[model samples]
Target: MHRNLWSGFCLSSLLAVFSTLSGCIDSRGIIPQALRFDDAKLTTDQTIRKADRTVEWPRDQWWQAYGDPQLNAWVELALAGSPDLAMAAARLRQALALAGVAESEHAPQVKLDASVQRKHWPADRYFYGPGVLGDTTGWNNTTALGMNYDLDLWGRLRSDTERALSLAEVAATEERAAALELQNNVVAAYIQLALHHARLDIAEAELKQREQLLELARERLAIGIGTQLEISEAEAPLPEAHRQIDLIEEEIALTRNQLAALAGKGPGEGARLERPKLSLHGEPALPSNLPLELLGRRPDVVARRWQVAAEARGIEVAKADFYPNVNLVAFLGASSTTGDMLNFLTNGSKLTYGIGPTLSLPVFDGGRRRGKLSEATAAYDLAVEQYNQTLVAALKGVSDQLIRLHSLHEQEIFVGHGLETAERRYQLAEEAYRRGLTDYRSVLEAQSQLFDQQFLEQQIHAAHLTAQADLWVELGGGALTDDSGPAAEQLDAHKTTLHLPGRH
Candidate 1:
């Protein structure tokens, strides 16, 4: 008994030594090199200094701030019906299922196996001994229950589960990003429709003015005070003005179709849409902690950050692969080749059972383990770089939108003043022409100037509205917040160089 006890101790010590030596693959050089971006370090103080920083972040339904009920309804419809969003949602569900699969790996597994057969042995004198039972048929049956449970001494299963969960988070954020994009598209199309309506109004007004000018020219000619040149010039502008009206009306119809498509409906549905009365009370404002908060606000950035986290977990899984894997395996069953069909279960001699621990050590595999580790580390670095790139692009998008909004605001002021002066000049020119104090050319030139300024004013106004929409989109469309899943900073906090068991 003492010798047996010593033999068991020696076996355990040998196993321990073998396990320690099995992890000899050089994993010290396989480490990720890419670094996560620090949101606080990305300076944006001077860029948005003039922006109103007192307003809160945009709400979930940010489009409602435009104060247009029709816009609100359309946005809601798009959210419910958009196929792009549906696809994104499906991807998220698939990711969640995969995560569940990974988690299941950490749990113990049990299986039942059973088989039954009737066998016949031929009575050949040379193949069987004299006393052997031959030329007989018997029932052969077996039934067993087996179980396996991993010890998880290396945390391989845990890291794999974590990676899958992080990928699920990435999918969730992508879904949010898709939803936000749909909303932006719907609003953008509606804004274009509104601008088209405004332009149509201007075109119709110009056509009316041209008709009145032509009538005035005819009256002057009948009173022997105007030349044929005046009538010809007035008629020429009338045709062009009508054509402008037609073009604007066509644009309006096309824009309506675009809005319907964005809502995942037919063109006819969009045709029923009334002119949008979109308006905002004040200029869009930024938050005081724009740069620092943007990491959590932008869905794309959040998704990328989650991807990095998943890859980091992948590195852990790979590192765990270099260690030994231990599993507890057990089975209980009965088998019989004689007696009744149920003899296997009733006879004590047929009983069979086993329970033991199994160990799998990676001795050598032609550098397969090292290759996997290198691959994992490379994947982690790639994800980190992608996250960093996304963050940079997000910041640039915000700054670009803000700059456009500011420029549009300043241009709107100038265009308003120019429009007022043009309207006054056109009125004076018409009055002088009717009194025979100026020629028809002066009236035509003044009308041209007034129309150009009117178009310019409308253009600036439309730009301001579109730029505001873009800013909201660049600001993440309010799809993320404190209540959202893990933030980029939180994910980055877990980022570190992975080391093997004994590597310094």
Candidate 2:
């Protein structure tokens, strides 16, 4: 009896000491409560205006830069039709909802539960006094309410909440990236269709000119002045131009179908785009050595950066599992093991309650927790590497686009001059042949040359339009304006996303 008493006393003292030490650990979790991305400072670029080219972007409507109302309408329809945009919007909401869940965890957990039970005993059972009564068949009734909570002795909860918020920000950034990409696709399709129509028109015009030359050659052959070879040569270019038209038509149809899918309607939904009278202007000058400070403006980069932060917080969560966890459980109830339920509730109803913290120490787990922490840490490192890779890729795209724009513009200029000279040469050749200064063969050669020139011009024109679109995509498209978001916050302290850190 003495040994048992001493052991119990020693245990009580040990508990008292441990309780004082446990005060250092708290269910309040991390200090200051919230981990905010506001602390992440972004570097600014002072050289944004040094780009040497100062041209205004088509602000109200990017498609207007092409000076085509039809293109504007088609692009708008595609933006409205994109199912991917809708999906992206929905996902953003989902992530925000998950963030709300994490935020809720920061508050005290509260719960309520109610239940009832009935029990029966055999008449043979007897206890206490009144042997005859105890031997009677009987039933028992009980009702109860319960509540339970876990005390956050480690920073696990706080880390989890921060991770959730980061994920939400990542979702929002992804949505923006998806929207931008969709817009670029719509515009690209519209421009391509317009370019094909332009080329087809030029091809048909050349084909008509060839038909006129062929008629003249046949007349000469009938008069015995021209050979069958001359007539055949003049007719050759006609089929080539028609063949070009067929290829262009095929491309136009396919592009229209692509636009249709983008608009979220039947494959033929978007407004038909007319080929704009595009003034073959020299290449659009892109901004050079853009401020690295605005690198976060790219949604893809920002999203990736947030992912890195989420992984970092995950590491902390794994580390937390290495510590002890404290849970508090409690209940209140009334019960009576009596034959009469009403009588049992009359002053004899049992009432009870329980409140205490449970400490779950990390003793032996076969290294599972350690493995998880290592995995989380590795994932964080990978995310960082990916962020750097994205940054480099974005810069490379901009650089390459700039070079192509210049080269394409120069090529178009020379091709335009060549087409004009060839047209004049064909007109002179026809006049000379009619007056007998040249033979049917000279007119035939000139006509073919003109046909070649027109076809070359068509290709060069398309190349110009393609290069322009490339520039838009590189500058991240849309009206060139304030490229940075002051209102958009970094979502994670260790990473950055576009919602002002704590606003979402």
Candidate 3:
């Protein structure tokens, strides 16, 4: 009874020493220095505030709003085949697999181990005991089944798993962002093709007009009422008009090739593309939820937010390292160098089995744990700042698109009026020249003015279309919804708020 009491006291004293040693490695001075930015708390810029906010959030297939079936088909094709998206999908899968690895830490691990080898015992008089078969060779064999499980007393495994899952979420959102960007590229390139077609029409018409004026000048000269200079003036513009047609056709071909490449097809496929029929009926208005919903709407922003959450979990994982780890371990095995190899398995005396709990306390690591915690905290701060920057840039992108669209709309109206006036002025000038009331110079001036106005109109129209597509991209292209949360719930569940070293 006295010996039993002594053994128990010694065990208690040993545990006390372990606990005191563990307390020496402090984690009090390390903490994350960055705070996450709240989307709702961020003030909306005047640019977003002043814009018309009547439209709903964009639909998932926002490109279809342009009423172009071909565009929709191309976007779908790109989503299916683009290398960029495929890579993003692969990265997401990899992250999910890593998350699985982390989660497996919570479950018991079982392993089977077996070994067999031929051995020889040398007869050394000083090292060998008196026994039979002292110099004999024999088969040595062993087999064991072992299991281990971590207790996770400090939530380390949970935080690690959560961090991995958050990174997986980040990959998913980045994949979505890549898809949206692909869609935008397809639409923008298609719009350029349409603009080239419009320009071609203008060029062909101008060519025809120049030919007609050249013929009319000849007739006037034949009747002794027009000078040779008039004929030369009309002929001069014909080659330029033809050149313009050639340039626009080249642009159309190049844009078609670009669209085909975006869809992961060859230049020959682009050669078969028809002229794009893209139209936007009205201005794309801002959603009622502006900067607030913008957080979830933009895939890039969502990805950054997920990254921040993952980093927050990383800090937790690092903090957990400062504590002790406990693991339950069990093993059952047999080993023998005598009799048959199977004797160890069958003989009860050769069998061995044991189960116990193992403890690991970090008594000293020369500030390694503190350094890791510091690194994790710094990474967390970087992620938060990146998220903040993404949010700001996203809002700025929306405002910039809105401003361009508004300006393009106003420019389109003025260009349209100018085109009409130039048309009337050219018609009057032509009539005056035919009636011998003015020289060819006045008619040439009016025609040049009309061509300039027409070109400006087409340019403004293309700008308006491109701006609309950009706005759709900025608004998240229907990836966002009203119910999208800030992804704080999961992080909050495992959050261990700690004070910074210098702060309260």
Clashing pairs in 3: none
For all candidates in order, the CA lDDT equals 0.80, 0.64, 0.80
Q: Model 2, which residues run further than 4 Å from truth?
A: 1-61, 116-118, 122-144, 150-153, 222-224, 227-229, 232-243, 271-291, 336-349, 437-445, 479-504
lDDT string, candidate 3, 1-504, tens digits: 999999999989988998898898877877777777777777776667655443444666888877778888888988888888899899999999999999998999999998877778777676765565479787677899999999999999999999999999999999899998999998888888887887777777778777988999999999999999999988888777888899988999999889889988899988888877776644444544556766555889989989999999999999999888999999999888876656556663268899999989998899999899989999999999999889888888888887887687678768768877998999999999999999888988988888777777777877777888898899888775534422221211111111111110
Q: Against the true structure, candidate 2 has what lDDT?
A: 0.64
lDDT of 2 at 230: 78
Which candidate ranks first by TM-score, i.e. highest?
3
Better of 2 and 3 by lDDT: 3
Give one digit per residue, the lDDT tens place, for model 1 in 201-312.
7778778888999999999999999989999988988777888889998998999888888878999988899977877644445555556565566888889989999999
lDDT of 1 at 151: 87
